[model samples]
Target: MDRLKALAFTTSLLALVYFFTQTKFTLSSIQWPTSLFGGKQQPDFSMYKSLSTLSVQEFPLDPAQSRRTVIIGDIHGMNNSLSSLLDVLDYHPGSDVLIHVGDIIAKGPHEGSMTVLSYMASHNITGIRGNHDQKVIEWRGWLDWLHRFPDGRKWLTALERRWDEAAAGGADPGVWASKQMKRHRSPWWRTIPKDWKIFTEHYKIARAMSDAEYRYLLSLPLVLHIPHAHTFVVHAGLLSSDPRYKPRDPRQPLARVPTVFGSAKSKHGSDVPKLRRAQELALLSDIEQNTDPWVKLNMRGVLKNHDVTRGKDGRPWSDIWNRDMSRCGGFEHDLSFDDAHTTPNKHKMLPCHPSTVVYGHAASRGLDIKRWTVGLDAGCVYGRKLSGLVLGRHKHNDLKKHQSPTPTDIPFGDNFTGHVVDTECQLE
Candidate 1:
């Protein structure tokens, strides 16, 4: 019995050594789920939420100061179009403040996207977190882990240089070598190096990215509040039930701690595979069946229910936000946009006060402009036009004084426009 025990231990140790030798790295070298959206990495929803909500910024240094806030819609890496739009608006750098409605990267050329970000950073442009932007940020974390070690950095730098040379049509067929990966059929997956396929396709872009650029994306806020304009800007719509609604930090996680009910009762079956599938579906149904009006789904939820929840329809949160201003957690009276000297009420007590929200996550419906909300994702990366909402200083004052007693009927504050992009591009 003692001899048998020693043999088992030896066998286990040999197997472990063989595994590491075959993989060309130790188990510690493998950053599990290093790919975007958890390729092989374990999903830690809490860590994801914390990293995602790490940044939130307020608009207007002083509400009383003269300001012209220009809020642009999703620019899915269309730098040329963004430049054209800014020129059209004749953007005044010092006096006019620029804000994006999220989705700052993905879809366009990698280099172009970097340029756009550099421009925004230099110009002090800020935005809320869009789904695409969120995905990229998540990808950034994995890339950071991959490149953290010296050996990893050396491997990545060599790979990135090869890719860049191949992309430029150099004699070396660096990009050609990755063709074997096409059998997998994921464009993202194919971009990863052969030995390093454990990581994400975003590695190519991430390796090329400067540290400052990554930091800029890390600093994105989930929501921006404009006190003078009485507006809240987010990449997606707001859920009043969320604790973050009141403070609205972009760097904070938006999802609540999922309440776990007792496991659903299941009938025992001889077919183990069938039983497992049934269990998965049952768990999914429980999450989907949650009746809360403000339960916001993260990327994982959407991907899981992409097929299951199809064809079902419900009213958008903005459309149903017609309750009294006080009930909606809004001010009793309109704040003066013209007065930069005016301060917000410190002792004001109120329930959920609904304000106008400007967002851009819904691209399928295109630009959805309503009385209380503005959806600006025009699917530009899908070959549609890149849109922008210009909120002039004069319009700010005009809307502030003209607040309708009926909150639902409040006028849309910004002037919307789109720049046409003829070529169709894939959505990230």
Candidate 2:
């Protein structure tokens, strides 16, 4: 009888404690996380119920002479490619118009290249936002996307410990990290001499930008209709491929396309592979009907297989929670304008708008230097090669300014495209 009575008393006391504590806890607690979005590098997409169709679109059409307009593809972060391309085009700054296809960030030799390239764009270049550039914007929460990394956890704790001190002291963690990386400065980051390190480390991304500038970059239309050549210029090509584009709504913000559920509009989103996937599928009928003995397989052969490759490692990392583990995680889209399997004949490119399309998201290995996009994106950051395409009256093999080879090329470690181009060095 005594034990039972004690037990009942304790239970009653606990109930009273819970009832009384509820209000106090509610009143005293800190703010609930209303901003569900993640940090600059990651964000939460669940906040938006549906994705807005508002992906990028094309700029106004250009009307002029019968001359051709050069369109380049993804640059990633390789400013060297851009430089060499300009040199090739002999771009007269104001006279010639160059269209950068997309992807202004990620992968390449230096972060600073973006800064330099941005400066160049303000002066002469115009561009489209590639999947990587979109990723950069989306990663920063410009567009709604699912969150993976926990909030404010982009940096390791060690760096976080020194963040406030660095920020308060007007020190940058990335610079400090690079300084501390003194000894470990991988062969890649140290290719350029130390004298130029400060300006060069982030030279590409550090050239001061204005709101008008970034907005200008963002404002650039994905498609550039050239009435001059009767051609349409685009970054990764339209997903629908029919040219029947639906404009994204202006009022509401757009949402991220979930990797698993697929997109209601199309399986592919803004990513390069998705755009290509749609094209491959659309072209299948043409490939299948190739009755000619010379023609190879049609679009089916190219579109049938899914691109398993993505991310820096060239592996799929789109949505881990969604895609099946068994699916091949290494599907890579072809970089060159033309591929062998597509046409069913010799290696040939799609019938590009004869006027011109220039792009460079892809990198390639070189025999001598870090050849920018041998096939495409020739390991630039790894000190391989910086790549770009110069479209100055594209008259075939003649347009390319051929230069003889030197040492810098190899399969292994050191022998990289150590060749440097100093654009920012100001002379007294």
Candidate 3:
């Protein structure tokens, strides 16, 4: 009897504690917070895979390609800084061929910033599509996602259904997003930005591309080959010998798309075509499947093919590998967390242009200098500022002193995870 009484008392005490704990700790809703996406939930490889990989005409040379050209790094939407960098470079209308690596949109100042990119695109800046560029593309594929998730889709459809029923109609994304910010606590929920309309607008661009222009952008080679200069240019990274196999750009018009985009016989696996085209990317169901990204354009929607050689420490791919030439022999690393050397699963053409390959997809924040790697992306998206290499003759040297352009404020990665402020620091 004594034991039974004691057990009952303890049970009551424990129950009381449990009830209090539940009252104090349990949340009434499972909403995600907006801060989580500030920089955490980047786009997956599948995002990049969705964008139509583009290829274009033989780079005419800098008098066509330039005496040299200015190859800038990735700009995750840091628009203000991007403008400053352009100013410092003394960038004129046709003096140089600008190779923008990628990540031009999505993060940072994606707002009025469209005007900048649109201007460049209209002028034929040769902007290579980055992974961020693809995330929006992937989002397009899932346009009806709001009506897809179990709870989310149901809630959305409920509202829309109700409106549709009365012919009142459509939920405003801004209002919905504001509510999400206020109510969501899920980590994934926070990844959205306050100005998500930028996504819709960008989609409109891709969706509305003139049949010719759309095909042209889609036809852009994953790598830009400047043969006269012996230079190769890509948004992220490249291998030595590019694959001769070419797919017609699935974009509109489709007449101009080329079969083979660039120089052949690369050392690395950068020549793989899977990650370079939009049609190929759509083939994938998820991002984690593409672990080894030979080149990643955006964190989201990136579809990559692991460079088998990338797993090897020294002298990665033999195709793009030049026993004599140096730069980009191994996989890229991730320093944000464990500093583990995680290689991407995508690839691009190699021996771009020719000898002096200009690139902007690879960031140098983690690895100081990757082996045999000549990365031009200076991580301008993370508030670190932007950088661009000038393939031009220097005033000091008549024999072509490679002119290094001053970093510009292209505003590529400013709001990488929707963490932008009203304004950011100027690079100049």
Candidate 4:
């Protein structure tokens, strides 16, 4: 009986040692209270996975404070352009607030993304998620999901090599993935290498991202509101149809709208052939009128090729945005929170002050500056100037004296007060 007892103790000690070695946790480093029985606690990734699509952030500057607030559009890995633009603006890091519209990476110099992320972190900048940024999150999320299994890192590295090799020969990774998915339809996830080829060139950048940088990217909200500046910043554009449209799942990125809008790839997702030309025109009219986003339920009403009406240079989503959400009863109707201090949720239907919107992601039109809506993406990756919008602070007494204008009374045309700042692109 004593011999058996000794053997059981020895086995338990060996198992504990193996666990410690596997997890890299030791008795000296472990927190006594939380590490009950000396076990390593796994991080809870639920919050990150379920992050909100819309986040309301306030930067209420004291009326007495004097500072500049600037919003920059799609960097697209243009570090030199960003640096030059800041120089042109005479950016004062300590006294200024910087906000970045998305697409901070992709389709440009690979080195720029890391530089941009590092700069934003150091400067304490706020940002929204661009489509490219969403692509990064999806890719990163997929890789992370794979890492839960054994030999995942090895598989990911090997898969990266495969993607690089395919791209070297002028092959489209997404097409390749589509073919693979089609061929193995029963269990798609198993066949997929957990690598998305659309962002093949960005894999290294994605992999090299530090934990904090990854968190920063993942934490980016889809929409930003600055009441003081009367500005709302978004990656692409907001929907006027559902002024109060909250996503069915806040966990999903807010910029994703299922329609024939956006890049060419997104154009092919739905069946638009069924709708007649007149029907298509009516849907466009409905969209313009800020009616329901979907004319019919189950995504069948709108014509898929309706975007062609906007011509080669697509119609700006802002052009169709008929109302200023901040002023209209709309902002109040849409927000989920009940109070000014509380964040919105699904259950809450609260009123919010409307604000002007400044957005990027539409580069074909380039530097579209309307009275209420501004598109700052000047296609920096395509050798266009990177743009910034500068809003100077209003003095305390001036702010008090400033009367808020009614929605219809808001000034338009040349009288719009914001300034557009730009810097020449430096492409290699």
Q: Which of the numbered candidates is closest to the native, going by highest lDDT?
A: 4
TM for candidate 4 is 0.57
Model 3, 313-425: lDDT tens digits are 33332223332133221212111121223434212211111133345544533212232334556556556657665444323222212333322222111110100111123
Off by over 4 Å in 4: 1-64, 161-195, 242-315, 322-354, 393-416
- Worst ten-residue run, lDDT, model 2? 293-302
Per-residue lDDT of 1-428 in model 2, one digit per residue for the tens? 99999999999999999988997798446322233323243234111111111112222122222233344444556566556655654445444455555555555544454554566456645655554444343223321121222222322233335545666787765586577557444332332223333222233232334444455554654444433222333433222111121111111011112122254433233453443333323222222222121111001011213322222343211122012111211223122233556645322212211112222343332211221111223334455544433222333322334541222222211121111111121111
Clash statistics: count for each candidate? 19, 51, 95, 6
Kindly indicate the candidate among 2 and 4 with the higher lDDT. Answer: 4
RMSD of each: 16.3, 16.5, 17.5, 16.4
Best by TM-score: 4
Candidate 4 per-residue C-alpha lDDT over 1-428 given as tens digits, one digit per residue, 9 for 90 to 100: 99999999999999999998867755445323222343554333222221122222234333245676668988988898888777666677777667888888878877888888777766557777776776676666656655664444555566557667777898786786566456645331352333446346565666777777777877786666543344556666654433233322322122122233333322122332211222222222334322221111011111233332223344445654433232333222333333435544423322222235677877777887765678788888899878877665532222212321111122322233445667678784
lDDT of 4: 0.54
Error of 1 at 75 (Å): 0.5
**Where in model 1 is the C-alpha error above 4 Å?**
1-66, 150-202, 227-229, 241-314, 322-352, 395-428
Give Cα-based local distance difference scores for all models.
Answer: 0.49, 0.35, 0.41, 0.54
Ranking by TM-score: 4, 1, 3, 2
* Arranged by lDDT, best first: 4, 1, 3, 2
| Runs off by more than 4 Å, candidate 3 | 1-68, 141-219, 240-356, 364-373, 396-428
Scanning candidate 3 in windows of ten residues, the lowest lDDT window is 413-422
lDDT of 1 at 346: 24
